[model samples]
Target: MQSFDPKLDRRRFLIAGAAAAVAVPAIAQDGLIDEPAAGTDPDVVHNISSFRARDWRPHFSSLSGGAILVDTGSRALHFWSSDSSTYRLYPTSVPVSEELTRRGRTEVVRKVVGPSWAPTPSMKKRNPEWPDFVPPGPNNPLGTHALYLGWQYYRIHGTHDTRKIGRPSSNGCIGLYNEHIAQLYELVSPGCQVLLI
Candidate 1:
C-alpha cells in the first residue's frame, strides 16, 4: 500500500496553481504519520485554521488512495478504503436529520486556503443579511478548513457548529467538523477524489 503522510512531499502533491500550492504546508516524511492517538491531548486538537487551502485540486488521483463519500440524502458519510473495495465505513458526528443535508455527485476540483466565505446568491436570497466573506476565525461559518466542492458556488468546509454535524444546516454546502476538515486538508491534495453521492 502507498503511504499517506501528513508531512507529505510537496513535490509529490499535484496542485492546480501557485495559490493552491501555498495553501497547505506539505511536510516531507518517509512513512505515514501515525494518527493522533485518541485522547492524545485535549488541549492539542488540531484547529481548523492549521492547514487552509486556497485554490488547488490537481494532486489527487481519482483512482488512488482513500475516497470519502458523503450522501446527504440519507444524512450519511461513508469512507471507502480504496476505490476497488469497501470495508472501512465511518459515520459522521450527528444524524443527518435536517433537510439541508443532500446528495449529488462531484469531483474534487479545487481546494482552498484560508478560503473566503462568499455567500451564494441563493444563500443571500434566503439570508439577505449574511456576510460575503466570513472572517477566518474559529467561529466563522466556514470554520477552519475548507475543501471547495466542484459544485458551482458550493463547498465542503469545516464548521464551528459541532451541534450541527450530520444535521442539515447549510444552504447547499456540506458541513464538516473543525478537526475533521483540518485533517482532511492535511491528508488530501487538490483533485483528490470526492463524490457526494
Candidate 2:
C-alpha cells in the first residue's frame, strides 16, 4: 500500500504554485493574458498581442484620398498614401476601456497644426479637475498636430506623453508620438479615410 506523505504533497503544491505565479506575470506582460490596463475598470479586459505589420488592402477598398487604419487591438496605426507610394506603421495609444472605444469608418474632417484641446462633457465629468480648455503649447494634449475625425471629440492626434503609445491609455482618441504624428500629418489631408478596427 502506498503511504500518504504530507511533506511530499506540500512540496509538490508549493512548486506548482510558484511555477504558476512566475508564468502568469510573463504572459500578462506579453499581452496574451486577459486583463484590464492599470487604473482601468476590471471589466475592461484587453487581450491583444504585440504589434504585427498588416496589409492595408484587407482593411480598405482603396487608398483613395489616403487611408488610415487604426487597429485598436494591436495598438498600431497603418497609413497609406493615395498613390500607395507611402506606407507607414505607427504605434498608438488606444481607448483605456471598451466603452470609450469607437470603431468603424470615419474621415478626417479637419487638419490643424498646434490644435487647441477641450475636455469632452464625459471627460470633464469623469475628471472634474481637468482644465476646461488648453491652448496649443507643450502641455496640449493634442501635441503638435491633430486630425479631427468626423466623429465629434475623436481625433487621430499626437501626445506629449510618449509613454501612452502602444498602450490602452487614452479616453477614446488614437494617440501617436509627436514626431510620428507630424510625419503622418504631412502625408494625410482633411479628406483622408480612417478605419478603427
**Candidate 2 Cα errors over 4 Å, as ranges:** 1-49
Candidate 2: residue 127 lDDT (0-100):
99
The prediction achieving the highest TM-score against the true structure is 2
lDDT of 1 by residue, 77-153 (tens): 44444454442222333323354444555656676656667777867887888786777776577788777766676
Query: Each model's RMSD to truth, in Å?
Result: 17.6, 9.6
Candidate 1 lDDT: 0.57
Compose the digit string of candidate 2's lDDT tens values, residues 60-119.
898899999998988889899999988888899999999999999999999999999999
lDDT of every predicted structure (CA atoms): 0.57, 0.90
Residue-level error in angstroms, candidate 2, position 145: 0.5
Name the best candidate (by lDDT): 2
Weakest lDDT window of 10 consecutive positions for candidate 2: 42-51
Instruction: Give lDDT: candidate 2, residue 50.
Output: 56
